[model samples]
Target: MMKKKLWSLGIFIILLSIIVYWFYFSKPTSFPTNEQLVAEMNRVFPEATASIIQDTIPIDERHVLAPFISKGDDYGLSYWVWKNHKWKVASIDTKGKPMLWKLNKSDPSSFYFVWNIDPKDQISSIHFYLIRDRGYQITRGIQHYNPKVQMGKRVSLQEKSYGLMQLSGTWVTFMNAYNKVESAKQYPERNMFFGWIPYDQKDMGIFPENSVNGASYSNGEIGLEYLMIVDKGQIEIPR
Candidate 1:
C-alpha cells in the first residue's frame, strides 16, 4: 500500500508540471514575422490574395492586429491570437471596415475599434458613437423610462489610414454600470451599439467609396462586431 501511494503522488506531480508548462511557458515569446503572417492570411483566406503586409500592431503579448493590402487593391484586416502554442488567425475582413474587438469580454477597457480604410475613400476623419435608444416600458404595474444615452469620439485619419481607438473612459464607465443593472440582462436588445460616420476634409459626411460593398470572411474565433454607419441626421446636434 505504501509503494502504491508513493507512485500515485509521483504521477500527480508530473501531471501538474506538464499543465503549468503548457499553459504558461509553451506559447512562443516572439510575435510572428511578416512573412509568417502573410502565409497564414493566405492559408486562411485565399480569396484575399494578400500581397503586402502593411503593419503588425500588438494589442497585448498574445494578441496582434495586422493590416494588409490584397493583390486586387483591397484594404484588409486580420486578427492574430497566440493559442495552443501557435499563432492563429482569429478573424479576417476583406473590406477592412471599422470593427469592435472585445479582447476581454467582461472588461470594458479591453474593447477597441480597429480599422484600415482605403485612402481612395477620402475619409479625413471618423466619428464613433456609443448609443442606447430611450425606452418606455410597463412591468408589473411599474412605469419605467430609460433615457437615451449617446457618447461620441472622433479620430483623424490624416496621420494614418489604419489604426485603433480604445473605448474612452466615459464610455467604459457607462458600460460597466449598465452591465450591473438587472434590466440590462432582461432586455439585451436595448443595449448600446457601436456606430460610426466618416467625414471628408470638407467636414461633410459621405459614404465610403470602397468598403461599403465587398466580400468578407471570418472564422469566428473572436467576435468582431460590425459597426453601423450613422447618418448625420440620426445624431443629436448641439444647439
Candidate 2:
C-alpha cells in the first residue's frame, strides 16, 4: 500500500510540474497599450496621429509573441507590440486602394510601397510620406504600372500580342500592347499564354463561355484583342 501511494504521488508531482512550467513559460505574454503604440508612432512622426482596434483576424494566431493591441476608432491608426519591440503602424490602406508596404529588419523603419490598384481606376500610381525611425522624411518613391484592360476589338493571324498576365486568384489583369487575338485556324494550336503575375494560380487560362479557353476580339480600328482569363471552379470578371 505504501508503494502504491508513492507511485501515485510521483505521477501527481510530474503533472504539477508540467502545469507550473506551462503557466510560467509556455503561456503567451501581454501586448502593449494603445497609448504606447501611438507614442511610438509619434516618436517617429510627430505629425502622425493614431487609433487602435482589435485585429479582425486575431493577428495573435499568426505571431507567437504579439504585442498588446490598441483599438481606437476615433483616429485612423492602430498599434501593437510583440517580441519586446514596439512599432507605430501595423498596416494601413488609403481610400479604397491598398498600399503595398512591409517592414523588414534591414529597412526596419524604411517602408517600401506598391500600389494595390484596380484596373478600372484611372489613377495608376500611389504617393505617401514615410518618416524613418531616425527622423529622416521621404516621400513615396515608387511608380506602379496599371493593370492592362481589354485591347481593341479586332484580331489578326500574324499578330504576336497575346495580352497581359492575369493575377491568379485575383480579379487583377495585365494587358500587353503587342498581344492580339488569334484564331485556332491560323495556328491550329489553341493554348493560352501565361505571364508572370504575383500569386500565379495554376488553373488560369482563356475561357470560351463554358470552358476556360483563350479568346480574341476583332474591332475595326483597334485590331485584334488577345485575352487570357483564369477559371477554376468559377469565372471571374476583372474589377
Candidate 3:
C-alpha cells in the first residue's frame, strides 16, 4: 500500500513539473504593449518622428509586421521580432510598392502573395498577371515592347472600400503584377508592374500600369501597402 501511494505521488510530481515549466520557462517571459510597439518603430527609423505605426499585424507572440508612413510622405513595411526581452526590427524593405511576395526556401514550387490594393470607385475585381516576358527588349538597348503576362484569375471585391485576397498555392511563381478593373479586361488606366516596369509607351499597352508601380510614378501615385511573411502560412487581413 505504501509503494502504491509513492508511485501516485511520483506521477503527480512529474505532471506538476511539466505544468510549471511550460507556464514559466517555455512560455514567453513577457509581451509588448501597444505603446511599446510604437516606440520600437521609432527606434528602427531615425527619421520616423511623425511616422506612426498603423495596421500592425502580429504574426506570433514574438514577431510582428507593420506599415509606417513618414512625415515626408514615404511609406514601407517593417518586420519586427521580439528578442533579448525586447522587440527588434528584423529588416525593413524600402520598396514603395505595397505588394509583398514571399518565396518558400524549402519548396521552390510553393509561395504566398499578398496585396493591400486601393481601388477607386466602381472597382469590382483585381487581377494577378504572371510575368514571363518583359515589356521591352534589351538586346541592343531600352526599347518599348508589349508585355505578355501569363493568365491569372481575378478576385472580386466591393467598392467604396478596399479589397483583400490572401491565398496559398503552388501556382503563379516568380514576377507578377496586379490591377483593378470594373469588369473583365477593363480599367486599363493604371497597373502595377513591380517586377520592374519597362520604360515605354505612356497609357499605351501596360504603360501607366507598369509606370504606376515599378520606379515610374512617384510615391504620390501609390495608394496601398503590402506585407510579407516567411515560415508563417496564413494570416487575417483587416478591412
Name the top lDDT candidate: 1
Clashing pairs for predicted structure model 1, backbone only: none
lDDT for every model? 0.86, 0.28, 0.41
Residue pairs whose backbone atoms clash in candidate 3: 98-226, 191-209
Winner by TM-score: 1
Query: Per-residue lDDT for 170-226 in model 2, tens only?
Result: 211221111233232455222323211112123222222211121111112211122
CA lDDT, candidate 3, residue 184: 40
Q: In candidate 1, which residue ranges exceed 4 Å CA deviation? A: 1-5, 8-12, 23-27, 138-141, 182-189
Residue 208 displacement in candidate 3 (angstroms): 8.8
What range of 10 consecutive residues in model 3 has the weakest lDDT sum? Answer: 228-237
lDDT of 1 by residue, 1-239 (tens): 99999999999999999988897678566887888888888887888788888999999888899989989998888898887777888887887789999988888899999999999999999999998878888989999888888899999999777999899999999998887784557555545788999999999998997865656666666867889998788898777
Q: What's the distance in Å from true for residue 181, model 3?
A: 36
Q: Please identify model 3 stretches exceeding 4 Å from their true place.
A: 1-31, 60-63, 82-86, 93-96, 99-104, 107-111, 114-126, 133-167, 170-239
lDDT of 3 by residue, 1-239 (tens): 99999999999999998877765456444556556755765665554442555566654565455655445544445555555444566654332333433333233232233322222222344444333333565556766565554434455544312222333242333322222231245434233232321111121112222112322112222222333211111212234
- C-alpha RMSD by candidate, in order: 2.2, 22.0, 14.5
